[model samples]
Target: MTSNATSSGKTVASAVRDVFERIYGDPLKQLESLITATGLPVYKDPKTGALLWVDVRELRLRFTLSVNKLEKFIEGLRGGKLMYTQCRRCGAKYFPPQVDCPRCKASDVEWREVSTEGELVTWTVINVKPASFSHQGDYVVGIVKMPDGFNITAWIDADPKTLKPGMKMRLVVDRRPGEGYITYWFKPAF
Candidate 1:
């Protein structure tokens, strides 16, 4: 997670490629023989002169989030509010709210709208990103504990250097780009 301004300026994927280049140097493709014109996925280590395995398997990820008990949360998002549930019996609260009570063994819960104020607990610059998040620019991910002591994970709109733990922040609901869905985020406190 070292940032040198130049390297830090590059995208996550390009940064990873730079790391590979530093370790292995550049790999040149070789056309050693034309055995009836056949293409293969094989390479040899330049320094070791040993054969290396090229993985052919590719991985992709997508999830189907269930909104059964938490359907109200989605509704609140559309209504321009962040909502969560509190166990009526035990007074325990949920951030990514759930319907059932875990501690009190009771399903009695109350859905409440979360306030917009928060204090940053921890954060990181998303210099490296997942495949799906690649299109988004390098962003800040942060954990913030609201006044109720429930933690919410979301992107933070602020400079990395200016970001610090225990700084006041505020929640904002915005329409996510491309997907066009309302999601929550944070900004430096007023």
Candidate 2:
């Protein structure tokens, strides 16, 4: 394959992933079908007769992001207002505020209050979750591209059974107890 790039110049894992994809590109569905049809968790190498056991172990991933650099974002959260960073030089905006603006190749950015109203563009429910979020019921993750063109990632507050793309959404900040951090979410616009 053509030379792939990583932010860190080291991408051995990525290269291995590329090799695996070249060998079995997107085996998720086909593998699932085989597992479903055979009723066994077994997969034998196509080229070699070596057998591989599909471990039933499940893994979930939840990440903690620090808002140390984006203190205005946290303030906005406490004020119940969504905020994003806009580059002072080029006017490039970032939803999940990044310190640097790749567009302008500049780190000089300013925080701006964003509109709460937006339309959901797409979403998915995490049926199988990671350990940290396992305690919580299946949550919906969605993206809403505001008028600023910066899409926000947050849990959408609505019944997963009734959610649809292009629904009206309002951004809101939620105080998660125990963890005690300010995070944002989407609520159905009634």
Point to the candidate with the largest lDDT.
1
TM-score of each: 0.71, 0.61
Candidate 2 ranges with C-alpha deviation above 4 Å? 1-66, 177-180
Among residues 3 or more apart in sequence or in different chains, the pairs in candidate 2 whose N, CA or C atoms overlap within 3 Å are 60-130
lDDT of 2 at 146: 80
What are the lDDT figures for the candidates, one per model?
Answer: 0.76, 0.73
lDDT of 1 by residue, 1-190 (tens): 1212233355444654555555444332233232224455466778999976554463535478778878889898888789999999999998889889879999989999998898999999988876456556899999998997789999998898998889999998756543344688999987
lDDT of 1 at 169: 96
Question: What digit string (tens of lDDT, one per residue) describes model 2 on residues 1-190?
Answer: 1122333443443444455555554565666787899887788888998998765564534478776888877788777677888889898778777779899799998888888788899999999875445545678899986877878888888897777778889877755422334567888999
Residue-pair clashes per candidate, as listed? 0, 1
Residue 131 in candidate 2 has what lDDT? 44
In candidate 1 the C-alpha lDDT for residue 114 amounts to 96
Looking at candidate 1, the ten consecutive residues that score lowest on lDDT are 27-36
Model 2, CA-based lDDT: 0.73
